[model samples]
Target: MPNVPRKPRKQVAALPVMVDPKGQVRVLLITSRETQRFIIPKGWPMKGRKDHHAAAIEAQQEAGIIGRVHKQPVGGCNYWKRRSDHFDYCRVKVFMLEFRYQLPDWRERGQRRGAWLPVDDAADLVDDPGLIDIIRTLPKRLATKHKRLALKPATMS
Candidate 1:
């Protein structure tokens, strides 16, 4: 068979964020199992899940935390996924997860290290350029969303 270039695989990611008492946005990042690089919780799309739900599941498994995940995508990033015999390109859709609480113990806790850092610091720590851009622009995106929400008329129900 002749070689043909494969299309980028689709993936989902959760950008877990919390606001400090000082109102600073902090992002939670986990170390990738193999590379130990800083990355948000992300994985392949589940067989029977909405993409955002799958991203939430990934966050629970990889980062031991859960939050309110936005239904719409905030942004996306492209990266090369290393496979056993080859590298595959992946496109990741990212959703913002409003931080709730963290579990003391969770799966993959031992396999990876998780940390909460200021947005700018986390943006600088991640290696993927696209992901970095997403992290950097997250605050502006959130502000835009908030403004839109404020503009909506209130409903009495």
Candidate 2:
């Protein structure tokens, strides 16, 4: 049998975390407009926009939260599904980006709704374990890094 090239997978940027006052962390989950499934906000990269910009936009549009990308893309996961015309699995790649921002006042959107879940409970709310894991580690990692840097001593004159 001859080897055939598979279709290139599309890239999607997702923001899975948000921080709130009282120093608590939350994961922003979105109900899909069409599927009604709980998912982290995500979207394809927009023209002339940076990856982080796309991520922020997705967070606002899907979750109705205003946030900024906190770290470099942590990682990604790939899965396969059949396309409209075929029985073969088409690969899909989902990128993970951590976001730091505050929740916005919830107003009715076209069809989607956003919810903020405590970091500990986020995994159960999201369908994908990969996304869950991302939410799990984000708070500790970000907090530790920020604290460590903040506590570092200044160099001697």
Candidate 3:
């Protein structure tokens, strides 16, 4: 086979975690608008929003979710996008969001469905190996995050 040049991958921001009232960490998956494949809510960089904020916006638009998005990415993964007759490689940076209220209606409410699951179940549900690895580690990351948060008050002095 002849070697073919690959196009530069595009960047996207993804929001994958949701913390429940009981402190359980759940991962959110939304169906892709085009293929209905399960994926985290994701989108291209918005005009003025920061990367994580853009991810937050995607979470809202795609899943009717509103939450506090962490400034740093939890992980990244590469996937392919299908257009009319071509595939484009896309690199996604995933961020974690602290769960908050969900709106009854949102921009993409009719276009997709969102589901929350345990880290292991989420890993099984998503297609990307990179995402699965991140999902598998999310529980541990959440534990560390909660530990740090629990210590914040005592350390404030």
Best by lDDT: 1
Candidate 1 lDDT over 57-143, as tens digits, reads: 999898877678989988899888877788777899998888777777788878998788888999999999988998898778778
Model 1 is weakest, by summed lDDT over 10 consecutive residues, at 148-157
TM-score for each of the candidates:
0.88, 0.67, 0.83
lDDT of 2 by residue, 1-157 (tens): 2233476445555655545555566665667666677776666668897766677667666655554454456555443323456433222234343454434433335567667677778767766666667667867777776622111111100
Task: Give lDDT: candidate 3, residue 89.
Answer: 73
Task: TM-score winner between 1 and 2, please give it.
Answer: 1
Residue 7's C-alpha lDDT in candidate 2? Answer: 61
Query: What does the lDDT read for residue 124 in candidate 2?
Result: 79
